[model samples]
Target: MRPTSEAELSAVISDATGPLNLRGGGTRLMGPFAGNVLETSGLAGISLYEPGALTMVAYAGTPLAQIEAALKSENQRLAFEPPDLRDVLGTSGVSTIGGVAASNASGPRRISVGACRDFMLGVRFVDGAGAVVKNGGRVMKNVTGYDLVKLMSGAHGTLGVLSEVSLKVLPDVEMQLCLRIEGLDATQSVEAMSAALGSPFEVTGAARGVDGSVVLRIEGFEVSVRYRATQLQSVLARFGAIDLIDDQERCANIWRDIRDARAFASGDGDLWRISVKPSDAPHVLETIGRNKATLDWGGGLIWCEVAKGLDIRAKMRVAGHATLMRASNETFAKLGRFHPEAAPLAKISANLRARFDPRGLLNPGLMGAAI
Candidate 1:
């Protein structure tokens, strides 16, 4: 089933008697689901764009590339810097704006800016009861009372099916430079990233590759970038040898690799994404020994490639959550997609699902057991 408009989408949900597998772009498929496929790709196109206002409104299925191109023409961009995981997940399709919102995908710049949810100004979605719900508006001040716009994001389509989205954008940076440090162990890498992030230089990106190379990015006017690079070099001299990458293309590619976890793309194992405090990163890496891992968000986000069916959660001794990002169907079913919530939080989530989807027909069991 494919919906072309909000009314059509509502009607489809209203009449559905079985589980409907909600999909947008189909690039982030978690596992095999038991339901009739409901594609949102038919509901495409940008509804509105105001360059001066730094705001954009697009239908749920609008191609993300189209939105980016429009923003680029205005010298602006989505500050969250959503990542393209098709290569890492081995899926082929144009990533849709709705999918990006549903998954709340953000890249390396999250360390400086925020997640996708932070940029959302408004949202339109269809509840499980076949009712159209609109929350927030095109501008931030209009988004008063019950911030459902944020609540919908990162919900993974379990609460409702998004029909349209309003987002806030930022102007493009004038220049970007990456400061690279090699031969740092995990502990040293975290300390270096913490020092850079905690500094007054305004670092935009901090990530550690699988080969133990740490790169810190600073973006602004050319002079500002150059000035920060010089100061950061002096501050980080204690870590190891430093290399400055001023070539725009090279820096872009390096950040892109870190953004998408490209190092783990070609491997043969289930992929896990762990979120922990920057100070606890080394411990997490030590716990999951010998696995290929890449650190992002200043070491708070760790992407580890482990043997299939190995549950790292049982071995974790720190305070963090692990999400199974890429795995075989069998592994996903046995382990689950998101980390298990605590009892109280689980009850709250169940109540939310029940309130939004009384019929339990939307992406049932995709996130957890059906209500």
Candidate 2:
């Protein structure tokens, strides 16, 4: 349906049911078609701007690239640096502002800066009832009622259909550097990475691979980055980094791949994203050591390639959370794509679904009914 206004959009949604799929460019929503889809691409444009206050309100369907480009003119950027899913999905869909908030796709800088949810100021969306609603505001200090703005973040369009989003942008850093610390096993590397995070010196990116490779990044003024690079190098010497890469081109590409999980983009096998505590990384990885794997986010994220017949959910159950990053259609359908949670939370998700989508609509099982 072509919606020229918010009312038309609400009318389109009101009449749809039985798995309402919320789509922007239908990018990540690919694979299989299911249920009624509500496309927000028609409801697109920048509504308001507060450059002095470092804020902008944009329609949900507005492309993230557009927002970034506008922010670049002012040398400003999204603090969380949300990743573009196209790299991981192997599709050229322009990740929009709504999609970023919906998926909460934060990057390496998340450790120091914040998550996408952390920087979101407000949102205006149409609920399952097709009623237009607004939450939060363009300012930071408005903490009136329940934070529906943040609750909508990472909901993946399950809670509501986002029409517009308010965001916080920061002035771009002058310089960025990535320091490679090599030759430390997963255990030692995690300790070193954790130590760096705990220090007064701020390390923006911290990651370790299963192959005993660790990379740290610092972004700020040239002097600050240089000083932090040297200090971090000295701090991580116990792990024995043979070299440091401070090059601009190399640093940009490396972190880009890291944020997008390009290292494990081999689409032939099952790819899983396991999020575990830094301390439990070694133990959990060892538990699934037989599978092909790579560690990222300083052992916080484990990308494992498991056999088609293996119980991926069983393996992930040992960790705090996990997701089937990639898999065949049959594999996804038979084994399920999401990790299982406790029964109580399952009930809560059911209630939430009923509340947000009483007709059992809205990307049914896209994130699984249990979430």
RMSD of each: 0.8, 2.2
Model 1 worst lDDT run, 10 consecutive residues: 362-371
Checking candidate 2 for backbone clashes, the offending pairs are: 20-362, 207-298
TM-score of every candidate relative to the true structure: 0.99, 0.93
lDDT of 2 by residue, 164-203 (tens): 8999889998888887777676688789889888877888
Which residue runs of candidate 1 sit more than 4 Å off their true CA positions? Answer: none
Task: Highest TM-score: give the candidate number.
Answer: 1
Candidate 2 residue runs with Cα over 4 Å from true position:
1-4, 29-33, 368-371
Among all windows of ten consecutive residues in candidate 2, which has the lowest summed lDDT?
A: 25-34
Tens-place lDDT digits, model 1, residues 284-319: 999999999989999999999999999989978898
Among all candidates shown, the one with the greatest lDDT: 1
Model 1, 359: alpha-carbon shift in Å? 0.7
Give the alpha-carbon lDDT of every model.
Answer: 0.92, 0.77
